[model samples]
Target: MLPSNTLPNPAILARPRRRRSPMTLGAAFGLVLALVGGGAWLATRTPIVNLGNEQQLSDSGLLQAWKDGAVIVMIRHAERCDAAPGPCLAEPDGITVAGSQAAQRVGQGLHELGLNGADLLSSPKLRTRQTAHFILGQALASADWLGTCDPQFPAEAMAHKRPGHNLVLVTHNGCIDHFARQQHVPGGERASGYASALFVSLDGSGKARILGRLNEPDWQRVLASSGR
Candidate 1:
C-alpha cells in the first residue's frame, strides 16, 4: 500500500553493518608504543663526532662541519710570532707566515664543516683580526665577547647571544685558559705546546655543551656532524 518513493531503497536496506575488528585496534596501539619508545631512545643517544685524531683537523674540513643555529668556535691563533709574554708584545700582529698557513687550514676546516660564509667575530687584537681574516677569509666585526678574552663570556651572555648565529673567535691563550678552567678542561701546561680548538654547541633550551676539542682536530668530521 506504501508508495515506492515513501519506502526505503531495497539496496540500502540489504547492506550489512560492519564493525571494526579488535585485531586492527591492537595492531595500531602496538605501532604507536613502538614509535614512542624509539623516539625516546633516540633522544638519549649522544651526538657523535668523527675526529680521526686531535692534530689533523683541517680548515676546509672544519668549515664543512659548522652548522646553523647557535654555535661558538674558539681557536688559539695558529702559531704566532711572539716568543715572550708581556704587555709590551701584546699588540695584535697575528700569525706569521706559518701561522697564516695554519689559519688557512682552519679556514678549510670551517668550509668542510658546512659554513660557506659564517658570521665572523673577533677580539680587538690585530692578531685576532688577522686570524679571522686568514681562517674565515673575511673581515669580522669586533665584539665585546672577543675583547673580554674570557671563555666564560658565552656563559655570562647566554640570554643575549646564546642561541643565535654560528660564531668563530680568534684570540689568545687567556681566553682558552679561562674557558678551560670554567669548563674544567686542561688547555695546556704552558702556552708554547698548547694549540687547540674548542667547539661549543647550544641546545634549544639554551644549554651549551662541548662538542669537540682538538689539540689539532680533524676538520672533516666536525663539518659532517654539524650538517647532520
Candidate 2:
C-alpha cells in the first residue's frame, strides 16, 4: 500500500477551482458590458414600427376594401441613394435599378389585387413619381402635401376621400412615420421597408383607420396565398 503522506488525496483533487482574480473578473465583466452596449446601439439604429391595437387586415380583406373603394394605401417610394435628402424632382440620383424592379413587382401585386380605377397620387419627388408610374403604368398626379413629412398631411388627404374610389399615395418614410404617430399606431409593429404599403380604411364619416403594413415579402405571401 502507498504511504498516506506520499499519495495525493482524492478529496484535494475534487476541490472546486479557485475564484479568478479581481482584475480578470473585471475584464470579463467589461467585455459583457461592451457586448451589451453594442446590442443597444444596434437596436437604436434599427427602425421599428408600432401597429398598436388596431386590427390588421388580411390580403383578401385589403383586396375587398379596394374593390369597395374603402382603402387608402400610403406607400413609401422605392430605394434611393444614401445621399442627403433633397428635392428629388431636380436631382438625378433617384431610385436604384433594383428599386424600379421592386416597384414593378408591387404594381403587379396591386393589379392582381384588382386595382381598378383607383386614384393614385404621388409626391412631387422623382422617386415617388417613378414608383407610381411603374406600378400603375401611367403618370400619377403630383401632390405637394405628400412631398413633405408634415403630420397633418394624412388627415387632410383622408378628409377629401371620394366615394367608390380607393386612394393611393406614394411618398416618403418620414411622412409615413408622421402619419403613424398621428394615428396613435401601437408599437411592436414591424417597420415598413422600401416599397412597403400601409393600408388604411376610410369610413362613411371620412375617418381613416389603420389596417396594417404590408412589406415586399408580405405582398409575396399574399400573392402566394391567393395562388397568383
Question: Which ten residues in a row are the worst by lDDT in model 2?
Answer: 46-55
Off by over 4 Å in 2: 1-60, 83-92, 186-191
- Each prediction's TM-score versus the true structure: 0.57, 0.67
lDDT of 2: 0.73
TM-score winner: 2
Off by over 4 Å in 1: 1-68, 84-92, 150-152, 156-164, 186-195, 215-217, 220-228
Tens digits of per-residue lDDT, candidate 1, 22-57, equal 999999999999999988866754432324443333
Clashes of 1: 41
lDDT, candidate 2, 31-142, per-residue tens? 9999999887666442322222223344336556777999888888887744535333334657766677788888887877776677888999888888888777899889
